[model samples]
Target: MHTLKRVRLAIFLGILPSLVIYLGIAVLPIAISFYYSFLNWDGFSPAVFVGLDNFIEIVKDIVFWSAVKNNIIMMGASLIFQIPLGLLLALLLNRPLKGIKIFRTIGFFPVVISSVIVSLTWGMLYNTEYGFINGILSAVGLDAWQHNWLGDPNWAMVSLCITYIWQNCGFFMVIFLSALQGVSNEVIEAAEMDGATGLKRVLFVTLPMIRDTLWVTVIFSISNSFRVFDLIYVMTAGGPAHNTEVMTIYMYNNSFTSLRFGYGSAVSIFILAFSLIVIYVANKFTNKDN
Candidate 1:
């Protein structure tokens, strides 16, 4: 009885600090944000109760809608490029080849490198005159393909998406690689013995086994894409005509630039709600095959 009590006490003690930290750091802020969302406050003045007005204002906000559209585009881009490319990379590197470790490390290096640096590098790459990408295109007689990537409204979002895919695909590639390693070699050999080879083996055997991992990667990529801000901010600052404005960027502008803290909180809440719903639905699909 004494030992049971001691173990219980120890577990409670170990858990107490984390619970306190979470309450203070995460829970408290979310609660405060919720409270603030209902009031008109500039973040410094006395708050006034406005109930659902802030939320209503959000529906009327055009930039909010635009940001939402941009986020959806980013999510689509992640689905189109990041997941497939990451899987392809994982498949290629999963084989036993000399210097494969080096290749894997090199591939994942961009993911660990600071996003600020990646943004800056991509910004330079998109510069129309002297940027490396445009320079190469010009050298190859594709000079007309070069444009002010970050300055054009039509291409700004796509340009940012390209950078996002470049910076993040490798991380997911590593994840897929790890999951690929988890696939049973015996099953693969059996499939081969049954005359399944090449794309057939990959499609029928390898892919089905790794469906859970693929789902996880897809969901994570989707979530990350929705929350994108840093790259867009550094590269274009929601640019030429607010083309790359994501929800977070829109929220930041409302909060800081416009000093509409209450409205910004409302936007944040909407983003949070929408993101959670999307993630939850994605989780259902991801777990369906499991």
Candidate 2:
């Protein structure tokens, strides 16, 4: 009994720091936000208890709904483009080619680079007058395709989505690559012996073997889509009439810019609930598919 107690104590001590950090950074703030969501405060003055007024106002705000729509669009783009591109890149790089390490490093380079730098670089690339994309169009005699990529409402979200995909797909590539490496060589050889090669082998054997990892990437993609802020903020500031505004940016504008602490808290709470509900539905759907 004494030995068992000593082992438990040691294990508790080992995890105590992480537990405390999680509580301080995650649990405590959530609790505080929940409390603040019920009040009417502007970061100063007396906080008036407003109950559900803030939430009701949020529901009525069309701009808030627009931000929610933008977030959903971003989520869809990430799922459609980022994950598949990452998986494709991973599959391409999973072979025994010469200089493979160099290719893998290059593929993952964007993910390691700072988001601010990536945003700024992409911003320059999307510049209307002198951007690389427009320049290419002009040089190729397709000048009509060129427009204000970031400034135009129609293209802002699309541009941001493209940048988002380019910047983060490398992350999913590394993840999928690790999962691919874990797939048993014996199973692969067996599939090959059974005449399953190339696309047939990948589609049927490899993908099913890594389905769990794919599910994890899906969850990460969804979470990252909701949490996206700095990249879009630095690039467009959700600008050109808030065309690319997301829930996080909306929460920031309300909390800090507009100084509506209560309203911002309510927005944050709603974001949490919304993310959880979506993730839950996705989990159920993926399980059903399985």
lDDT of each: 0.90, 0.96
Which candidate's lDDT is highest?
2
Off by over 4 Å in 2: none
Model 1 spans > 4 angstroms off:
1-9
- Give candidate 2's TM-score: 0.97
Find the candidate with the highest TM-score and give its number. 2
Error of 2 at 182 (Å): 0.8
lDDT by residue (1-290, candidate 1, tens digit) is 99999999999999999999999998898888888899898868888999999999889978789899999999989999999999999999999999999999999999999999999998999998889989999999998898888888888888899999999999899999999999999999999999999899999999999888888888898789878888888888897777788999998998999888888888888988988998899898877755
lDDT of 2: 0.96
Candidate 2 structure quality by residue, lDDT tens digits, 25-96: 999999999999999999779999999999999999998999999999999999999999999999999999
Total backbone collisions, model 1: 0
The collision pairs in model 1 are none
How many angstroms is residue 252 displaced in model 1 relative to the true structure, after the best TM-score fit? 0.4
